[model samples]
Target: MSVVDAWRPETAAGGFTRDDEDVAFYTRINALIHSDMVVVDLGAGRGSRYDEGSAPFRKSFFNLQGRVKQLIGVDVDPAVLEHPYLDEALVTEPGARLPLADQSVDMIISEWVLEHVEHPQEFGAEVQRVLKPGGWFCAITPNKWGYVGIANRIIPEKVKNALMRRVWPDRPDMDVFPTYYRLNTLARTRRMFGDGAWEHCSYSANGTPKYHGNRSFGFALVGLFQTFVPSLMRTNLFVFIRRTA
Candidate 1:
């Protein structure tokens, strides 16, 4: 058995555990989805999850291609044009206005995208502009106060990029972007998406440890520690906000 299999037996048969973070994050978004709603995927890449070999079951939950009326993906990377789960794709410049019209979308979802947002005000403004009055904006990002975020902030860029390449060999170099962490913490996220214009809830969550160096012992140790870490110290933040205006 592989180290991950030995460490997480529940994921031995497939890449899912009791409280899988992907499952949890997607579940919330899926519940908000309806057949006729127009949806936008912010910072959507070229469907890298498929390239990374996500399990079929997990992929089913992540794919929103046919479930919604329109699935538009917007990202800075041109690779987004080839995104498998989007009906349409747009490549935009940083801080540029989205091509979408005001109040045109019913929902917007962002996964692993907020950390790279250097200007949260511009980001939030764009999101608010495109979404309908009752539209939902949901995202899952690494928590700025978490261990991974702290390490990322302290580590040298070259060293961190080198280490990430070694740890996630399957991930493409282009897919890795520099993180600013300006909108990562709960406080900042709340401020960006709050102010009576939106009804929002943000919380922390823990996922499987990925930096165990392929060692079963290390994986198990970190997994145990992850379970006991305080809420604010959890690795990920899930933000769900609905426009109330």
Candidate 2:
């Protein structure tokens, strides 16, 4: 079944989700926001840039407009300052410290972002510093062993950038960053986040292939891939953790 259809039932709590992971995630975020808590979205590119490839997931997030007391967007690319889903935007250097105060945020949402960080462990530290006690950080990232991630690690940056620009011409106009598979795998992610040893953590492999385009054959091919390949080889991974101290 398509991811969106899979998550249809749990839209009950608040917001929406295209997959099981996001259902649990948005449910938690919805509850926190009902309490007037603050949430930050990392790598929150403009909603306009959310292509057909990820539109369903993006729509679920967009559905959160008035539900949250406050939703903040932070990105290395200044163009994301225009994210419609965010109350405000903070643009900073790609691995620079977050502008938020320590322990000030109730939740962190990161979508298709962790793989691009130059220093994944440092990003973990920042997440630890900004999140309040019991605050959860939820992320969707590509698995390094997946076909897409292997291509990213193997391809030269300039060539890949050029290819992406050629294929998805709008990236240059919106926001595009390099991918470094540094924290893509479950083990690496766990070890890095272990730096803070946030009181609780969970990781789940999202059994979807990332190489698909908007075509049915593309979708079917990936569906076939997932059916035959091991779960670990699938493209998406979920990283959920909470700061309890």
Candidate 3:
């Protein structure tokens, strides 16, 4: 089930469109790349999020474009373990202890993964544990209070839970992603890192389309409104943290 043996590049597989903000968001993250760094891509998806000829979960393969020395991808999904660029792939339950040695990783990157994790605190601790002292941990997750988040929240909790069930009925106990954003804001996200162990470098609210080629002015306005009214932008949050010993 290792990626090296299983991966097969497909030309028919489409890539992410430039219209989505994720293109810019990922590019910005790519700028931080250094050729010598050992990067771990957590929850690295199928690589369709970036481009063809690329693996989904390991953004460095598409984003850094070979600037990275080594890339490791970790996800619970067996399909993701088959990405071509993954130097190694480990399958583990989301938010459980990662199967990596202490202080072994120089940088860790995850996109849109926090919402899927059942216990973010444990996940954060795992990130801290695997990172070398002064290593970087970067992630993007939906802001629970943003426009999309508000729309989700205004629904009855029972309905929300039902929707989660309908989408991922296979894992009844798994929190169907984006669960914590409503309660975990920028301030709260900073707090979760605890004491001086971590520092938040940035926080921003942006639009994330559920569908391709479907950008709307109304949705853009909502994102803009959330900037001034932090209470409104509950849909997405991006953060960069440096782990300190």
Model 3 residue 24 lDDT score:
53
How many clashes (backbone N, Cα, C below 3 Å) per candidate? 0, 0, 16
**Each candidate's TM vs. the true structure?**
0.94, 0.76, 0.71
- Candidate 1 TM-score to native: 0.94
RMSD to the hidden true structure, all candidates: 1.6, 5.1, 8.4
**How many angstroms is residue 117 displaced in model 2 relative to the true structure, after the best TM-score fit?**
0.3
- lDDT tens digits, residues 95-203, model 1? 8999899999999999999999988899999999999999999999899988788878999988987887766565666777888999998889778877789987768
Give the alpha-carbon lDDT of every model.
Answer: 0.87, 0.70, 0.64
Q: What would the per-residue lDDT of candidate 3 be over residues 8-35, giving only the tens digit for each residue? A: 1221244333234465556666777788
Order of the predicted models by lDDT, top scorer first: 1, 2, 3
